[model samples]
Target: MQQYNSLRADYKFTEEEAKILKDLQPRMEELADQFIDEFYDYIWGFGQTAQFLKNKDIIAHHRKKIKEWFINLFCGKYDMPYFMYLYKIGEIHVKIGLPTHYVNSAFTFVRTFVLNSIEVHFHNKEQHLKEINAVEKIIDMNLDVLTSSYREEELSKFLSLSSFEKTILSGLKKFNSYVNLFLAGALALVAFFAIGLFVYDIYLLFFSDIGIEKGILTVLGSLLVLWAAIELIHEEINHLQGKGFAIGAFIMLAMAALIRKVLIYSLSSEKVDDLLIIGFVIVSLAIAYWLVGVKKKANSV
Candidate 1:
């Protein structure tokens, strides 16, 4: 109750705003079905929606609940029970392992849908503006309460851990941070060496007895490897900034290095077996990299 009051206060959701929302309830009820239909269409585009709304019965129940929730948004009954209702929905979301990303995205759709509906139905500019403000505040407040469940879930898990376990977790996080730093440094060195390798290839091309064709191929191969190294470094930086670790980048580096070997070995007929082995490895790495990308996309959805 206190937390709900705090949220309402923070959003400046006054009694007048509540009355404004209540006044809009009839219109919202009329549009509820349209909102749910469009909502399903939007979530279905996520690709993983089937995993959640697996059966017709489940989908029907979910649709009903969503409609009720939508209508209740303008119920003008912002109280402990209302906030608790939202929190319970959030808890269910957490229990089902639903990503916070989906919650946020869904809320985005809801906000846009309601605002657009308001624009179409309300003609008085001043009243429309007031209703929009009230609606936005209430929706934001709802999202806040909903996401708080996730936060509380994480906090509870941490609180439940033994002191020693907590200490170990903290130490592991610190160690992981250090390891990422070390990896960044190592990638820097790899990029440096790659540059040197490219330079050396250029030197060999111009100064050595290598044929122009072979020399140019070697320099191009070196450049490819150098590009792969730089890409890996970029990926590592993104990981440090809280993105996923780019396993695909490492695979790319391996493929690039093997491809460089292939270019060099292709110059020697006697190295046919070596070339075949490298080619096979490169193909395998390509498939692995593709699979990593597919998995990442799925997880994001």
Candidate 2:
């Protein structure tokens, strides 16, 4: 019913269609492995998809898995758990950066194979129409739900990219692509040295400046600042490489800096106003993050 509500609402899947599918289960079981072999042979013939199946061992293994999955689709038991499983499949595709167009095109191939097989097997035109319609509806339902997962994943990437886009437009606009690349390389080198300094500061704190609590605080705070810069440098690298920005990552970095400040000095400092201001800033940042989420949701709608 979960799958029904989420996907079948569009397809109008009925118990009759479900029964037709289940009745074909035996034939599907018989043909699945053979069909999948032929299907994959076609896919493997193409360089674009064969590249993803780099491992030879997984080729047969995944073929078997796809056969099983394909047969189970006609098991007449589609539900929330089934939807969840398909959702995970979609997420894996997104995680691997599979293009959505490839997903749609692959579904078309499967749909044609199954529908043509049905047409050949059934004798009565009306019965053939009925059964094929059931198959077509179910395939479409699967596509709808699966593609929705892809869309959700793309939306997330889009949101993160918007942040990176803003940063690139703000600072890198004056520089050509080559100059931007040069600046990123230069900053990356600086970040590497800063990390080295951070490591050296650690040596100073423990061995060279033992028992000096303020010295330890200074060293710790410096390390934290360097880490923050390193985070920005990574963002810059991703920008240059045309990757999406993770805006929330920066928020976490900011929170880390605040926590470090409080840990190293603010907690023990005698200034009440300073502590109050820090508290206020933390609260404001939390509120701001929440508001951004709300606004993003609104904008998406």
Q: Model-by-model lDDT, in order?
A: 0.93, 0.74
As for candidate 2, its clashing pairs are: none
Error of 2 at 94 (Å): 1.0
Residues 1-301, candidate 2: write the lDDT tens digits. 2434556656778888889999988988888877887788667544467656768787767777678778977988777787777777778778777777777877887898888789779799898998988999888877877777788876776577777696786566666677868867876786687678667767777778345675577677667767766777787778778775546446645765675666555536576667677677877777776776786565333
Q: Write the per-residue lDDT of candidate 1 for residues 1-301, one digit (tens) a residue.
A: 4677688888988999999999999988989999999999999988788988999999999999999999999999899889999999999999998888889999999999999988888789899899999999999999999999999999999999999999999999999999999999999999999999999999999999998888988999999999999999999999999998899999999999998888888889999999888888888999999999999987876
Give the lowest summed-lDDT range of ten residues in model 1: 1-10
Score candidate 2 by TM-score against the native.
0.52
Tell me model 1's lDDT, rounded to 2 decimals: 0.93
lDDT for residue 18 in candidate 2, whole number 0-100: 89
Runs in model 2 with CA error above 4 Å?
1-4, 160-301
